[model samples]
Target chain A: MEIIKIENLSKSYSSLKRKNNVLALDNVSLSVERGKIFGLLGQNGAGKTTLVKILLGLTHPTEGRFSLFGDSTNNYKNKKRIGYLPENHRFPNFLTAYQVLYYLGLLSELNYDGLKRKIFEALELVGLKGVEKKKVKTFSKGMMQRLGIAQAIIHNPDLIFLDEPTDGIDPIGRKEIRDILVRLKNENKTIFLNSHILSEVELITDNVAILHQGKLIKQGSISDLTAIENEYRITTDSELDTFLSKSDFVNFQLKKLNGFTYVLSGTDEDGLNKFVDLLRLNGITIKELIKQKLSLEEIFISLIKDLDKVK
Target chain B: MRNIFIIILYTLRELFARKLFIAFGIISTLAIGIIWMILANGSVMINQFGNANPGYDEMEKIVLGFEVSAILFLSDLFILIAIFSCANLISSMLEKGTIDVFLSKPISRTQLLVGKYLGGVTFVFINMTYLVVGIFLVVSFYFNLWSFTVLLAIPVITFTFALLNIFLIISGLLTRGSALGMIVTYFYFIVLSPILAARDSISNFISSDILKQFLDFLYYLLPQVHDIVKTVFKQILLQNENVQYELLIYSTIFLIAGLAISFFIFEKKDL
Candidate 1:
């Protein structure tokens, strides 16, 4: 199901004295599906957070339309089924972790009587089980992030929006949060995650979208966005150096590590196969070969640079 | 109802856990202790308890007067602390990014703001209960006299402060900085509220009818919180029969209008 759909959305900020309008989101649009872990990527000030804020009704769009679960974005009731963990989110240091979740859960429409077990389960899921009563001020940054996630998922909404869920988290904590997200996804919950940690998003997102200057620059399955179609990384025994020096068959080595292996990328299968055949003709031992794609970070950087050129 | 109540609780929890609440607690205790010291002296206790010198008057009335004096004096101090405490309620929430968590919930923006406003008053309410009631009990015990009228000032002073709180919350939302919010609120409190309260007296001195008319207009329009505070305290003391209706009316107007505007702006704001 199309859980979220946005069309031609735009948001601009202006100050009366400035006399110039700052365009934050410019005619951007996208869709999210139910039960899919969708990742949103952008550099700072690219309107990634702005778009989320609009959908969450934290801000209104200047011009556009959006709907969630076939309901208008302005539908108040739809908010009950959604949860958000804002970027750099904070809770009062004075409250115990449990108090924070209990209050937020109540705000999410869960009764305290019914929410205790859920809060415990969530804290446990976030690796914060026994520390429920610890004051939030005493919690480290990573623990706070985990608690933030716990609050976001406390009510077990149909869709959850997590902004920088793993920010300031340790590697182990990041892995733990990833596991929690995976577990949520396995329960058929849709997750809309935004993060600067590309590797983390790359690991779990079903689909990825890149936003640049309030514009939707790229959106697709991670495989498709980062995929080098029909490209192959051929690992051979010590022939890359000579191949580069001799240069037969139009040289298509993406990278050559230690003069043996080459990440051979080509636009089409024909080009890839041609390079492979030439490597075999060189009589260099073919140790192994496998198809590969660019990392999400690589694709993200390239897409941003490409967008920069057009601007 | 549940959502708004929870948000209110959420806000109250934050304020209680903060250091300012603790600071207020210590200050209230110390102030009460000082008041106790003054009451321990028999002469000051009997003579200075009431506005008039202690006489063969009923102990209840004299004790009531003393308690009323303490309530009024502490209220002045409380207002300062309350303003400092509440000045950051909305401004800091938005700036520190905690407001987003609440905004994303199923609750309305107005609900959040009102909840926060009430939550701020909740802190004031709790502290006043401790500070005001404690002072009342001590004076009654020390002087061997009991009076219920002094207790009435609790709610009266609180609502009056709530009326003043409107300015603080509005300034918080518009300015988005704690110091700036407090400065603006204090400006309204110090300058505008006072000017509006003495509008008639000042008007009599003005030579021009136009300036006097402007003063009268400003007096009615601006939230004369000081007027509300003073009149309510006087009413509690039973010293004034001419109750100032503007205290209730103007305070209510300022609260509703300031709250309405703050909510409207916050709802449309991008957090």
Candidate 2:
């Protein structure tokens, strides 16, 4: 089921003397499915943040329409099911982590007992249980990001929009955040993760959308996009220089590495088998044959470059 | 109703947590102490003057004048405080992005704006109440004056008028800076209103009836801080027989106009 459907949405800003219009979202339309980790990847100024803000109703679109949970942006009931973590995620400096969640819970109209339980659970989930009483101003950047995530999920929202969830986090903290997102996915919650961190997105996201210059260039399951043709890297102790020189392998452009290793890429499995057999017949002992799968970052960069070339 | 309560609670929490209430308390205490000392010294000086003079009941008259002046001065000071305290309350929230988090909830913009306005007004009311009590205790204990209820009404009305006027003008506009907004408001209240009120006094030297009439019209166009101060002085100190019904009517008009202006501006504000 499509949880969010944005159709041809656009926005621009105006100023004196000149109407400088930023095509923040240029007729962009996309849908997020239910119970999936949907990654929204984009470079800076690619309208990722603008799209998130539009979905959250922080800014009205200049044109087009969007619906959340099958209801239009003006629908209040739809908003209750959606939670948001802004890019910077600044809370009132005076509020502690616990108070922030409790306040949000109250705003969401949670009952007293439910609010208390949710606040405690959320703080614990985000590793903020022991420091719940510390003012938000005293928190480090990573802690603030965690608290932002905790507040976004305090009410157990069905759909959460997280913008730059791990922007400034260290490697271990980023891993922890990825783990939390994975746990949320296991609970069957829909998450829209917006970030430029391709590796982190690749680790946790089930599906991905790449946005470029205020437009979505490519989007699909990670498996589908990163599924390259069968390529093998063979490292062998036996010398097959004569076999490689005598055969059509040279014409096929087989790459030689370190005098004993050979790398070949082909679309057909039979071609790979024949190549392996020829190496074996030539008295070459293969120590390891490893298949190279494309990483999401590589695919993302390639896709964006392809889009740029086309444009 | 539940949503309103939640908003109110959040606003109150924010206000107290920011130490505004404590700051207001300390400032109020200092102001009342200074005014009380000045009035007491003035009264003593007036009594000494009357003792040295012959055939003049200057002590009673000077005491009455001192009472009137003290109440007037306190009322004006309270109004100034109210304006300065709540002027940037909403604009600052918007600028800081705190308002966006609240807006992302199911709450409407109107509810958020009204909640914030009420919270600020409530803060002003509480501070005014404290000021009133302090003035009462100081005046009654130190001067042997017992006009408690009468003196309290001046601060209450002046504070309300101050908040209403500010809410009318500042609630919906996109002000460039808080200091600029504050300076404009202060100048309008202190300099503009007084200059407009003294049209007749200036007209005597210039000998121009048209300019005097124009100034009279201008005086009626804006809020008259002096009139409010004078009304409070008459009701509290002079024990005047007739209440200033016209001034009360004019204050009500200003209050309604302010509310209407605030509503119109807030409705059109982008967010």
Off by over 4 Å in 1: A16-19, A229-292, B30-61, B141-145, B235-241
What is the lDDT, from 0 to 100, of the residue A162 in candidate 2?
A: 91
For B1-271, candidate 2 gives per-residue lDDT tens digits of 6666676677778778878788878877897788677766754665565564424334444544554555457657766776676666666567634655676677766576667666666766677677766766676566564654445554545454553445334633556246666777777777876676566677778767787778887667666656555554466455567766565566567766765566566555544
Error of 2 at B270 (Å): 5.9
Query: Can you write out model 1's per-residue Cα lDDT over B1-271, one digit (the tens) per residue?
Result: 7767777777776677677679888988998898898877856556554544545456666677777777778888888878988888877577645878877788887888788888888888888888888898888788766676687777877886787777778777777878877887777777777777887788777899988888877777766677766766677476577777756787678678878888888877776
lDDT of model 1 at position A53: 91
Interface RMSD (Å) of candidate 2: 2.1
For candidate 2, give the lDDT.
0.73
lDDT of 1 by residue, A210-298 (tens): 88888888899998888777567778777576556544545454667555767765436777666667767877678988778899999
Q: Single out the weakest 10-residue window by summed lDDT for candidate 2 chain B.
A: B52-61
- For candidate 1, give the DockQ: 0.56
Model 2 segments more than 4 A misplaced: A17-19, A229-293, A307-311, B1-19, B31-68, B138-155, B158-173, B196-226, B232-271
Global lDDT of model 1: 0.81
Q: Chain B alone, model 1: TM-score?
A: 0.89
In model 2, residue pairs whose N, Cα or C atoms come closer than 3 Å (at least 3 residues apart or on different chains), thus clashing, are none
Q: Candidate 1 docking category?
A: medium
